[model samples]
Target: MILAATGMRREARIIARAGLVPVISGGDAGRLRGLLTAQAARASAIVSIGIAGALSPELRVGDIVVGDRVLIPPRNGEGDHPQGGGGERATFGGFAGPSTACGGPPPRDKLGEELLTVLPGARRGVACGSDAMVITAAAKARLYEACGGTLPLIIDMESHVAAQVAQEHGLPFAFIRVISDRADQDLPPAVTCGLKADGSMAILPVLAALLRKPAQLPALIRTARDTDRAMRSLLAACDVLARGGVGLADRG
Candidate 1:
């Protein structure tokens, strides 16, 4: 079976058409580990799908990224507590750069030979996942450098967990992330500010909040348009590979 992860409800809403109800694991490595620990052996393939911010200008909003490696920072020392210490609630967001600073090991490559045949234009990239999404020039630069200057075609929160789980179970895994924002862009603060803890977009509240900043409306519209395009592209890619039994990436 294919396992897909979509970070937020909006992103998840898009994949509903795939007729695959994504398992809502909240994107925490610990939580994901537990879920997969039991079922890992049964899963045929794992996929992490979601929206990510672009760390390089070469990638535009709405472009797609299919990853071969996933990087996640390790958790802080627990001191034998096993849990607790007031960490952020289990929520999915974006990539955290480097494993040493946090607590995770280096990314594991688990993309099997079969899936690669489906991803044609996927660039070889090390996708880093973090509790927090990387934004701003400094953070992006740090992650970019950590990857040895190879521009990240995509970044997301759940790919690392999928990769780790696949590794533990010796399963084939691949990550497909659609770019919702570019390197020069940040999610309109207003949109995120109105979001509740449960990942639902507070549309009216967000709009009310943004009413004062008419300047952002244009960009928001543009992002919406781009995101729509990306979604269509993703489904097209999936259909071409999943139904036709062809691996697009094999051409690479």
Candidate 2:
């Protein structure tokens, strides 16, 4: 079975329509870990599917960013894997030894490339995963600067974790992220305030937030539209994977 990790219920629904099992996390790292751990056995691969925040100006909303590699920021001597320094690198095929490198070379993921072929206008690049959402235009700028202007294609809260899990289990992994917000766009606070503890959306909180800040309605609507387009693209890619019977060979 192909397991998909999505950050929103909308994305999960889209994955379901493609006949893939999706685990929703609402951007909660702990919950995502639990879900992934609980269902890791039957999973032949893990697909990080959903919306992402653009880290490059060239990527506009609705553009799909397929990850050839996932850049996970270093955790300072935390957990089982102590950080020597810098981010840990995880690719579609397997995990590489820890290094401080930002964007050394673009790793080739045939699966990522194939997904791009099925998805026109989709670009392949490195994706950075964070413990939390990359909120605000200023924060996005800082992250780009921190990457030494390498300009990662996109930013999301869950991709790296899923990749890490796949690595631990020696399973293949890939990411199909769609741009939901532009690099220069400052996301309205309400966009995140609506999230529930389990990562699901609470309609009342979202409505309340919108009620307080009516000015943000237009931006919210635009984001919704872009996300819808992204989801459709994800569905199409899922179909391709399903029809193609794509599967990665076991890693040694």
Candidate 3:
């Protein structure tokens, strides 16, 4: 069976469209690891599917990034502490740890290449799995320098964890991330506050934030529009995967 790890409810819905049961890990690496550890026994492969921030300037909102490799920083000796009570509980938003040069899982080559066949126009590259948001253009450039110009196509929170967990279980792994923001775009400060401890968006925090800075409305609307485009792209990718049987263990 294919197990999909998604960061949001909308992403879960998209992965479900591809005939896999999606586990919502709430954008927390530890929680993602725990969820996969428990359910990976029956899984033949693990897939990380969701929206991601662009790390490469060439990427735009709605671009599909199919990762050949996942790059994540080593955990700071925390040793299996679950993030925010578990994937099920209310959780704080985003990752706060520093990134380092660490090797992560590679997608099964045949399956990985086949994604390009079924889903034309998808970009294939290394995806950086970060514990914290790389929010600004300057940060993305700095990250590129930090990686010695490794040119990560996108940045996300949970893909590395899924890849790492799948490696421990000897399962094949893949990542499909839709770009929700551009490389140079700075996420609104309130975006983080709007996310609850469980990784879901809460209205109260958003309202409070708007009350404090009403001028952020235009940026917020732009983000929402970009997200809508990304979601639609993700849905299209899911349909392609479903039709091609990309992750089916029984496929020859």
TM values, all candidates = 0.68, 0.79, 0.82
lDDT of 1 by residue, 115-159 (tens): 455666655455656555454444555554444446464556667
Residue 225 displacement in candidate 1 (angstroms): 2.3
Clash pairs, candidate 3, are 90-197, 90-198, 91-197, 91-198, 92-197, 95-131
Score candidate 3 by lDDT.
Answer: 0.68
* Residue-level error in angstroms, candidate 2, position 22: 0.7
Compute the lDDT for candidate 2: 0.68
Error of model 3, residue 24, in angstroms: 1.1
| Best model number under TM-score | 3
TM-score of 2: 0.79
List, in order, the clash count of every candidate structure. 13, 0, 6
In Å, residue 101's CA in model 3 sits off its true spot by 9.0
Each candidate's lDDT (Cα)? 0.56, 0.68, 0.68
Model 1 RMSD to the real structure? Answer: 7.3
